[model samples]
Target: MYVAVKGGETAIARSWDLLAAARRGDESVPELTLAQIRQQMRLAVARVMQEGSLYDEELAALALKQAAGDSMEAIFLLRAFRTTLPRFASSLPLDTAAMRVRRRVSGTFKDVPGGQILGPTADYTQRLLDFSLAEPSVPAQPARAAAPLPDALPCVLEVLDREGLIEADLPPAGDPDPVDLTREPLMFPAGRPARLQNLARGDEGWLLGLAYSTQRGYAESHPFAGEIRMGEVSVFVCPEELGFEIDIGEITLTECQMINQFGGSKRAPPQFTRGYGLSFGEAERKAMAMALVDRSLRAEELGEAAHAPAQQAEFALCHSDNVEASGFVQHLKLPHYVDFQAELSLIRALRAQNPQEPTHD
Candidate 1:
């Protein structure tokens, strides 16, 4: 009979104390403020919020600070904290058509309806390092056009839809609302909604790699970035007390619409299909990667070959979570002394049986 013991309590406590001390750094140096992290490390915060599946910028910044800039740890921290919060009524579905546009572009078309509005992006900037950034100076304010982009920019996909060139993007009439992913494990043969949600929360690097695999001919898909846009959208929720929905607040969002190769039957003429991706902030790369993976995953529905890894639902959704992946991988650092000792004893027995066996550890 074996009994478990509560070992390493004092050492664990001391280790954490040491960690706290290390996090603070030299006492002479001023500690970092949460506000500074929130403002300055906006991209980092956005990644945490997006991957963590939480929308609070402040909380995401706090998690980042606590994790010492490790994105995986920060996402885990935010997710752990988010589990404690109570859920109220769910918000009404967002109207992307009414989104307040900040940045908008299309690779498929040279000039979209509202003209390509390149608002607050570093896409065209030269890659050379700016040494001046080390010594901070107030940067000059960017010039603004007299009339900014229109309140709601038309979607490029919608333009294709008008000419009956793109497949219709609508849900089945009798389909139920999407099941909350947190409450239930993702079932195989997942609906589009759940698949999209999983991709949205999936690891960005993993998705990027898989997306690249598709472009490299791992899967058959010729993708065109129909449009990519980032901006604010209003959220509305209707509480039990209030019969009508009330405006909550605005949240920054990035959306990507990818156009893929024609998927038409003998009855229908050749037309384009779509892949969609959306994130909490200006995570364009993530959005684009997600779009590619999403299109790849739809191979089965389109009656195309599903031989690629990206097209497999189990392969994508099960391993996409960075927090879970890191936890399982890093847990090897913890004590495995007992198991190792058992293996060692078995090895010793085998060595005793064959004295001529060379000594090995």
Candidate 2:
């Protein structure tokens, strides 16, 4: 017998209570502390911050624990938390050239102005599982200071500019302030700057998969990670009230400069072009992928064929936001019996209107 259901509110409350209990887990055992998550689950924290657009490690750790290590879910949590945070000011765009770098590397050249500092990274380590890490070990060595900075720090672009190898910067001013994508809805046929901003906050896994498709010959573009840098860049804001620029707190950032090899065009001779990428926190892979996608989106500007999905800025940027994507995707599971019934009725009507011919053996 089909019976009308009751206690929906009570059931939902009970379910939530069960979920809370599950998330907490084993009251007898010591609860996993936020510090432990921050220190141990550092990568997860980074991913959350990168996608969430909130760079707080502690909050990210909490979100990671609360989301049970689902990077996307954690990002959603962090983003929700961030939305409630009241904003006081906007920092001026950081000049990466003046960044107090902790780590820097260049694929295009052997030695850069600031010698490559291979900071805290797991890049070279063997992927073998260390079972011994089940028991914690103490470190033996203490910290030490390094050498001084050079008078000049040369970006890879500077080298090309020196030789006059690349075309001149496009007009309309290079230093124009970018629109805040978070506050506004994404419009169709987005500009390169807006497209890049969207990709920076994009879901890492989504963008990475899209980037992989390109590598496998889906709208391919030969890309080189010209440079990747991780460092603390001081933020400044010139408030009208103050009349002078104020130095705010610094942020850890990863910047990727990509060199996309583009050949002959009617406007200019064959020359290399720049694909810029920058992201919050230490996210090398995300930054590099962002750069490649950023360059791909500029196909129209470069007079190249826009055949790839990555090249479509509207598609890429509009779907990049996890908040938007998650809400839309999960909304399908919500109560929509009325809509379903309507759809079913329409389908039944369509079938009634046109009868299919029966096939004979």
For residues 220-269, what per-residue lDDT tens digits would candidate 2 score against the true structure? 68877677888788889998888899887888888888887778688878
lDDT of each: 0.89, 0.79
- Candidate 2 — what's its lDDT? 0.79
Return the top candidate by TM-score: 1
**Residue 348, model 1, lDDT:** 91
Q: Report the CA-based lDDT of candidate 1 relative to the real structure.
A: 0.89
What is the overall TM-score of model 2 with all chains considered together? 0.87
Show model 2 residue runs off by greater than 4 Å: 1-7, 140-153, 167-171, 174-176, 345-361
- Cα deviation at 326, candidate 2, in Å, is 1.8
TM-score of 1: 0.93
